[model samples]
Target: MGTFKIEGGHQLKGSIQPQGAKNEALQILCAVLLTPEKVTINNIPDIVDVNKLIKLLEKLGVKIEKLSKSTYTFQADEVNLQYLESDQFKIDGRGLRGSIMIVGPLLARFGKGYIPKPGGDKIGRRRLDTHFEGLIKLGAKFGYSREEQFYGVEAKKLKGTYMLLEEASVTGTANIVMAAVLAEGQTTIYNAACEPYLQQLCKMLNRMGAKISGVGSNMLIIEGVDSLGGTEHTMLPDMIEIGSWIGLAAMTKSELTITNVSWNDLGIIPSVFRKLGITVEKRNDDIYIPAHTDGYEIQSFIDGSILTIADAPWPGFTPDLLSIILVVATQARGSVLIHQKMFESRLFFVDKLIDMGAKIILCDPHRATVIGHDFKSTLKATTMTSPDIRAGVSLLIAALSAKGTSTIMNIEQIDRGYENIDERLRAIGAKIERLD
Candidate 1:
């Protein structure tokens, strides 16, 4: 286990190029199993989750060629479906929630799929019933063993049908889309998670000859095709990383420019941040944050009261970014309520922030009120361990803006998504060191 010792109270200033989207990359990598042709992916992030997924692919006999630091060519010419049942494969599957997506492509191609219980942030009880229910709706049968905590699905000639997911689960939507792309008929998925990550998956599948309509909406129409061919695709820039950078710049009063950001894809994120008085400038695809931004008042409704930022389905603010938004709100000028309805346990991390001199009201398991300090950076650093990916990054941001040094343990959680985080922070004048 490694730790990050960070000296706080430093204004970060530099330009950073955002890496590929971790969520999109994971699904895209699994999409390779749909075809045997060469699938080249560019702008891949060197993150732990992606590395683990790649190792899983290699174990299943996918020939992966490293073309460069951020590029790779994947060919699943001889995929051994039985390898997915191995204990080693099951262990690797525990590293990420996206690992369950492999079940779709494998089942579509090989007529069967097996996956251990997927592991990710312990934010709440993430149910896979929606995923299995969608697959079963499309002519697939599933069986699970509670002792082994393993799931298995088998199907022959999947026939597409209308699927209205109980909730807009991102991975569930992606799995169904991947499965439906090669099914026998049209599949209509209502109330799907049409986030940018899922949109990227749909677009990439289209490029590979899958007919998918309603790319960025809650309803998706996928026309099942007989076969899917391989194609080269580049992953989108990490929007969560970009959002984190925005929070860091605001907290530290730094002027940072984030490059390669898809400005248009940031739906509701900009408006939500604007409520916190954060100004974001878009120069083409790049975002620039000015230094010494005097934090503005929290905007309320027509009645002039406290406003809230909450998570919803796609086009709404992402649930994964609620932690960063909450932390950033701590440095703003006024109070704003953050509601994380998707995950029950996500708001527990706010207790740590309250301990760090942040005025936070934990309304319940799903909501909190954050009162900003308005440039009064009086936080005293403390020792803390990372809880999850988003919360871990939020803690790092708070630690970096504190008055003293802070030690963060179990940084592997942080490494699961953000690529070269310490090095990137160092380039922007953050004093963070990795200690073993």
Candidate 2:
């Protein structure tokens, strides 16, 4: 249980660079197993979850080399497929939710894939049905070990076909696409998640000799290839962290610049922040946010109704950043309803904010209406436990804006996603220290 001790009411300044996308790294790392050739990747964020995944790969016998601080080359020329049947493999595969992805490539090339039920943020129930169902449609046999709590998918040779995903899941789509890339025939996926993470995966797979079309849309078509080859790729800066930084600047009344944000890949994140009355200035590829000394206001809909910030699929505001948006709204001039449609318990963290004096009503499991103090009342410091990755960062943002000292426990949840968050925040004048 790690802890973050923060001194509140402090201002932050200076420019910070967003880390390479964590979500993208998960999918991209797993794709390395698709080929036996050396694949070099740059801008891999050094976070706990990613490190754990890399270690799991090492255990499974992928040759990995750290060429630079944020770059690595991987070769699966002699991967130990037998490791997948070992108890150690079950422990390793259960370490992170992203471990579920390795199944796709393994099933495609080696005819089998097995993993212990994966683990991750406890925000909601993330079903693996999407991955298995899509793979089944491609002619893979799905199995489960009820007693051991394991999942298995195997196919001598996957035969791609049409699949309309029950839901547009990012990892699900990535898994299906990776399997389809080596299948026997054409595979069409409709209602696929087209998040930048998925798009990056598709483009990287293409570079590795896979044929995938519809890079940024809900529909994808993959033409099976015999095998993939090596390729070099770079990751986009994390948009979720960019959104968190923007919210932090407004909440702490600080002037901050987020550099190399890959503005084109950020989708509706900037405009969504703007709707909350924050000045999101675009200076080339960097995002410059000025101090909100005068406080910002929430903008109502054109029909004068209360603004509702809801999470939708790509080209819409992401659910991952809704917690940050809700926290930033605590000091805004008006009220807003945050609809976290994707996850049920994500709004449960609002009770911690209420304890700190922000006026918020948990309307339901999926929606919360927040009434902003507009900087009129300072949130009082409180001790709290981080619930999940997004919620943990949201609490951190709240602690930064509150009056007096605050302590946040279970900070490992925060580290799982954000890379050296406290160190990065401290560089910009944040009064935060890690308590070991």
Backbone clashes for every candidate come to 0, 0
| lDDT score at residue 294, model 1, on the 0-100 scale | 67
State the lDDT of candidate 2 residue by residue for 237-316, as single tens digits: 99999999999999999999999999999999999999999999999999999998999999999999999999998888
Best by lDDT: 2
Candidate 1 — worst ten consecutive residues by lDDT sum?
A: 292-301
Measured by TM-score, the strongest candidate is 2
C-alpha lDDT (0 to 100) for residue 359 of candidate 1: 89
